[model samples]
Target: MHKYVRMAGFFGLSEPPPIPQSLRNPRGFRPFHFAPDDRIICFYLDFWHVANGDHILHPHALMFTHSSTLSNYAKYLSVVPDGQSRRIPWEAWGPSNARWMEGNFDSSYYSYVHGSRFAYKLPSSYDDTGETQIIRMFDFNPYAVRHSAKVVPAENGEEGTDADGLRAYEEDMTSGITHRDVTSPSVVSAGSFFVDDVHSSLPYREVARAVQYAEDFSILIDEANIILLTEDHTMRVHTM
Candidate 1:
């Protein structure tokens, strides 16, 4: 018996499945989805194992819903081959790299694993299809940027001389020094009408123009809404 099995038994818990001889001990268990209605939990198990005499670390998943105890649960739909040697990076091991859309154990549940870009759908008991569906394969580039034209000055003019030149020089220096001073707040408010006009005229102007990287991607789903947290630090909510 594995040490984990003995430890669980000591706590009055049922013994878990024995680790395969080809696989090493598992580490880094991360829970992803929970269905309160059905008392179901989905989680990832990361481990290092020897495959073809090469050591590799990868992740697999399990779901506990109908089982009588924690030890007995449904393994993920896919399993790593015994001799497969794929080394996943240590930094990539976490819940942030995955997302889940929970459904009442009666209809449908969805999950996406980042590196694989595969969306898995598990149907409920009421589903007549009785088959799992993988759909909508899409590539995600977190560092994707929406390119736009750069702003440029329409024309340049020579500086005026004497009084006008001195005044302009002073104004330029003062502008640079005070650009972010307390007075700028009032100045911005004072130009509220102009700001509104600019906004209205360029309705499509990007407020926070920045590239979104995959690392900053986040998503949340509820019964009536889906919320996405993008790289630009913006929350986009969509109704279901």
Candidate 2:
């Protein structure tokens, strides 16, 4: 298995039915992050992988990369594949290159260091006495694995930048592959795509949650505050 595929096992993924071509190559969406620490870049990846078992995984995937890296990635995505490494030497690119690409990636810090997100979920029937929304706090400091340095190839005759022997160690860290089935876990790190093999972490936990009437139109979050906008154009703010 190519080393990069470790995210499959780390995220508790197994070979399932073929993914539609459109989703296999993800299209990113809705970029947001908990206030206070913008270090953890949270965005929705327009894709989902049917997990190895019987559960619907949340379709949100987080990616952390330099804005320039993201910009080049955008430009590269637009290119029709011709079986060539899209790696452009650092000297050949400039800020403008990334400025024109999808501009969602814009952080240059380690992280807010700590961040949280709020989701207003539809209430389950017959349970009126509860908070229908959830506020999940993520320890984003753990996933900042990339750095500007030369990457050395494996000394044991492996290809360049291929992760070596990380699967066994990472698998052991989780209770049972992953708790990411129907109920999302308090995991800090997650699967597939790319996280530097050298560093992966589980730093997420349920911090706080709240609920509002179905008429609540939208919700947003900042350092220690929650903002709600209703369909009637009235606004409400709550302290976290």
- All candidates' lDDT scores? 0.26, 0.33
Best by TM-score: 2
Encode model 1's per-residue lDDT on 72-114: one tens digit a residue.
3224213656777555532243222222222222112233322
**CA shift of 185, model 2, Å:** 11
**CA error at residue 102 for candidate 2, angstroms:** 23
TM-score of each: 0.25, 0.33
Q: Which residues of candidate 1, in runs, are more than 4 Å off?
A: 1-37, 51-53, 64-216
TM-score of 1: 0.25
Worst 10 residues of 2 by lDDT: 97-106
Candidate 1 has an lDDT of: 0.26
For candidate 2, the per-residue lDDT at 97 reads 22
